[model samples]
Target: MHDPIFSKSFTRTQRHRFGAIFLCFIIALAISKPPLHLLSPIGDAVKTQLSINNVGNMLLVDDGGRANIKPIADVNPAEYLQLPSDDAQNKRTSTTISAYSDNGIKMEKKHAIICKNSNYCKIEGDVRIDAKSSTILVATSFANMTKSWCVIEPYPRRGTSRVKKWRVATLEKNDISLPICTQHHTHPSLLFSMGGFTGNYFHDFADILFPLHLTSSQIQKKVQFLATDYKQWWINKFDKILNKLTKHNILDIDRETSQVHCYNELQIGLKFHKELLTLNSSPSMHTFKVLLREAYSLKRERVIRDINVPMPRLMIIDRKRTRVLTNEHQVLRIARKLGFEVVEGVATDLSRFAEAVNSCDVLVGVHGAGLTNMVFLPDNAVVIQVIPFGGVDGFARLDFGNPAKGMNLRYLEYKIRENESSLSRKYSRDHPILRKPELYRNWDQVWSIYLNQQNVSVDLRRFKGILVEALTLLYYK
Candidate 1:
């Protein structure tokens, strides 16, 4: 015998009770920091939020400069984040640091670093940060012809709650420190450094999706893009904002410094060389950069210090845990026969994906968030993406704004058997694969069981069109 008002009244009362408890819990947390010794992944999220806030303050305020507000975003934009086999928290790694290259510190595939403490480190070094947990990050340097990285560790650590001063000095005339990298350097030209002066502070600001400022000229040269209506909304938003900031002075892309694929905190458009600031392990962003730098036959290459130890090839990277596509192996086999290098790797992280793509001439994948790795590829690299009849077409059209310059789009239609009536009308249908469904209804629909029972063959004609399209683009130079 529940009264209408009484039943709802109980619900309301319980809600209020929980709210009070939650409010009190927040107050308790506000009063004191949690015991960090009880470190767990659950605390990782909280620590990250605080870190983002800390980085944001470093960029916006007159704290006159700090670590180029590391761009650890609020969201993990990875397309696939496979859960661990067990529910237990992973504790194998001690820390996560940003690693950069200088004279004394050396890189091996982006992570698994080696450092030699010497006075020579002053000429070409980067910054190191204590990002909570016993972890230290070795991030890349944000400066001219220099690279940096940060390492994260939880063992045999240095630094305390009050001070994080370590082996490197970030603010001396000898070594270009992280904070000084930002404050001291304002004229980042295409020749001296890379980004921060490439695009308009307003329009180019909108192109990159993060809050970074860029000047006009760099936007014109480094920002290689073909415009479309979809980009119009972003362009409009920036134009309005610029009108206010300029007082009609910084009129358009003509005046503002441009944004490029470089890493900066106040203005995060994109960064191709962020490894110089991030601490990644071998087979990582740092590794790729180290190899590319060596390709130029720099002093780092002539004197093969550490990374030259036969790092993993692109194909083995395909089998790494990051790649978890359903038909990955199958597609690789087919692509190999079709005269394409079949690398089976995933661009799970955006920055890492950018690094991976820079190493390849062609990128192919099923049309999914996983394939946005297109953003990472070199200009004019061909992308052949499979479009499942159910979902892919609409998304591919939007992902590529211009069919001419940045991306070469190719679509492969998925195979789907039509309605049962079409098969029934086939004259003398000897093929068991397409046998009349009415008579075949006796078979269990379980796919694996029936496949073992019946020999099947389908026409390969349709796939040839896609292969030809891919080869044509490959030879395009």
Candidate 2:
């Protein structure tokens, strides 16, 4: 009953509408689901372009200390897909990657790949990462490839910000579409990387060794001694003791930044004194003293000498830093008059220094790093520490008193009376520097006014009594 042409037109229109609806449904499904390209293996080029989350956004620096960071488009999931956790059926996978440095030095060129997760990627084995100004040594089964290329959690306390300045990359792989990015870098060597001339002799020579001592117990079997190029008088002489304790497994990675496995700790200061006390079979004091004597080839019988013949030598440490003797010439004159040999205490030749200290019966020094050389003295030697002002009583006892007692050495501290300090000349008698000594609770303020800037002239008449006391202990004991 309807016109045939009109019926055909209506049927064609219905078919066109149905086809458009089906196409729209297909588009929606495709949008909701992951792309098929994500399922396929990623290409090598795509891997190289993989975005490194926190560490990846680095400013690529050139040889002349210039950074060149190009603006790349945001990564697409289809082009750069994260591998499934069970991609290889949870099987352990391994790969190698090269780590580049700003100076074109390649550190850990071949790193063993471990695994990756959403938050972090781990690299198996030890690695050293170097930057323009710093070198880091990491020791762990796996390294973090996320925020910071750190193996140890919480990173190193001293160089946390410096560690973040590294630009890391991975060598191309054939089987894997993305290069298994490893977190490692390299530098010229440990010597240049440790530090430059700090101008602080105490920090340069003595305080530097404290961190190495902190790693004694954490080092299970091996120690890769770095910065051997800086080895000089004291380091060369005392390294024999280190060699004996570490059992000669101290491999020298000289002039190159390196990370040795099985060693786990590094810290500054004598904060680990308690831990150091428990390291070896014997007490640390006895063990260290014996090792030192062995290194210098001295006998126990030689330490104890005849009291009447003046066979024992006395050495006085003359400091070149703060809190020094204002009238050192006069002090030296008195020392010589008392038949004590006054040594400069600062030695460029460690062998000569060792010989001088080892031969002496009494070692005397103001409260400074120079006193650290007392380690070279004979077992029963007497140590006279001249304590500076500003409430150093407790600190003096903790720093040297306990250690000397432990090492079987007679320790004597000469506290500086107010009249003896040079501060008395500069500040008014009623000034806070003179009166409110309790304000020394702030270490920096105390250091500025008393320890770092002040000097002293010992009241010779009063100091002679302490000198006599030291001699009595050395002669009688």
lDDT: which candidate is best?
2
Local lDDT at 208 for model 2: 36
After aligning candidate 1 to the native by TM-score, how far in Å is the CA of 362 from where it should be? 2.3
Candidate 2 Cα lDDT to native: 0.44
RMSD (CA, Å), candidate 1 to true, equals 24.1
Model 2 lDDT per residue over 171-203, tens place: 122323222224322211111112311112333
Please report, as a residue range, the 10-residue window in candidate 1 with the lowest summed lDDT. 38-47
Residue 164, candidate 1: C-alpha displacement in angstroms: 29
C-alpha lDDT of residue 127 in model 2: 37
Off by over 4 Å in 1: 1-325, 347-355, 401-404, 407-461
Error of 1 at 13 (Å): 56
How much does candidate 2 score in TM-score?
0.54
- Per-model C-alpha lDDT, please? 0.28, 0.44
